[model samples]
Target: MRTLTRPAARRHIERVFDATVLDVLNSVDLVDLRVVVLQGGEQGGPPAIAIICESLGQIDLGWIETGDAPVAWRAAAYRALDQSLGRVLPIYGYQYLFDEIAMYYWDGETEDDAARQSLIAYHGADADELENMALPSEMNARRPAWMIAANAAASKRLPTALRRKLDTLDRASKALGGLESERNAWNCDFEIIQDYIPGYEECSSLPPLTLVPFEQFARELDDIARNGMEMGFMDIAGLCPLPDADRIDDWFTALRRGVQLLVAAQDLIRLDPTQL
Candidate 1:
């Protein structure tokens, strides 16, 4: 992980960004990559899609791998997953539409700044130059798993028709924060989150996890679904498109089957907190 002294980090952000207090970006880097094939159904389909899932305390986000799959298919992130963030902000990038771009971050230059700052990040097309730079991709995993667990465990949002068995749910209940694992899971999850997105709670924009019974601190995911926000805070990567000569028409939310499950939940589940 590349780091900058406090002053250096400030200069770097000002150099690349428009220097708007409205949207402050902190750091950017190309972290890792993966390879998988496609399997399109209707709304979403990509048989081969590489996906990475991560969790911190209560914040759970994912990364998607875009770009051509390697011939060997078994590349490593140099075991980048095994290391800690060292309190550094990790920004990333992607192709917005036709152009390629990298992602950047913000919030927490110091412990205090990190505690209570809110900044919007981006993917590709630099704020100053608006140039397309190549992002890095390092793939070295033996076999990446398809992981798309919901970030929300509260609201009783589980679907009536999705068919996740009770025993099955019971097993993954800690991450889901359900059954006996309710508040117990929430406390455990929150501490784990500090490691990944340290000082996230101090940001008022983010939802708080009160010890007041069972709650899900997934307001970021809600923002993404509601506001059409691009990948920044709680991010996703690696999308596949079926392109055409006239204009690209066939597009899928390429988490492969994992996304398919969410889409199914969306269709089958109603917006009722009592559903769970």
Candidate 2:
């Protein structure tokens, strides 16, 4: 039998917690549940629920019946999941206090047709192509230009300020088009995969767990946090640093702008699995 180290044990526990959240989402009738991962900056990690929005903002009675009161129930659900997982799992070395909100939508017969069409259009294959082609990985690696085009179309419908920000992002995407092989560009692609599809499991034929220990992990979470902080400060500093003010103001502004763009893009992208 393999001996599980503290970190290994903690990871197993975290997986269980993640699995639990997946179960809850899978069983419910909620159209779509968004799960945002929250992460802490330091060793004393602060874990919190980032956001939870239901489809059409309808309250599901099944969710509420299971000890989830109607009042601020989203936070309550997060706390319940946190407490349950914390009790059974050891969370060490998972210092990044990020909360991943898994958006789960109800799967139905309608989804089958959409999935078929998406598979045919994207890979020139049908459902059986799961064995022949790694569609998700391919799509994730090099997102279709159509996706951004769709986003651009949607952004035009937004308010003036947000539309301008989306236009800037479109420009940025265009500027970076041919440079996808660059380190920074690849990082951006990976970040999107991590953010939007946190629990994406590779096909069964592939290795089950790809996550590595802290020392073995390729990316440094702390470095990412520090870089984000620094970038924020520099943005606030603008062309010249202020005499006495903190430099993160510009960073926050940029962050807000980026978020607005995402919101606008989300509105444009039909997230419906059936829509594909």
Model 1, backbone clash pairs (residues 3+ apart or across chains), number: 31
User: Quick one: RMSD of model 2?
Assistant: 21.0
Q: TM-score of predicted model 1? A: 0.18
**Candidate number achieving the greatest lDDT relative to the actual structure:** 2
Q: Which ten residues in a row have the lowest lDDT in candidate 1?
A: 93-102
Off by over 4 Å in 2: 41-45, 54-276
Residues 1-276, candidate 2: write the lDDT tens digits: 989999999899679756755554453332333444444323323332222323221122232123322223222222222222211111211212111100011111124344445556654675666455423233233422221222233433444543443355454333333222221211122233333334322311111111112232223333333433333211110011112223224323332332333333333221221221
**Residue 16 displacement (Å), model 2:** 0.4
TM-score of 2: 0.19
lDDT, candidate 1, 1-276, per-residue tens: 998999999788556533331121111112222222234534443232222222212212221122222211101110111111111112211111101111122222222222123221333234353222212221111113211112222323334322243223222322222222211211223333333344534433221211110122133223322322222233222223233322111112112222322222223222222332
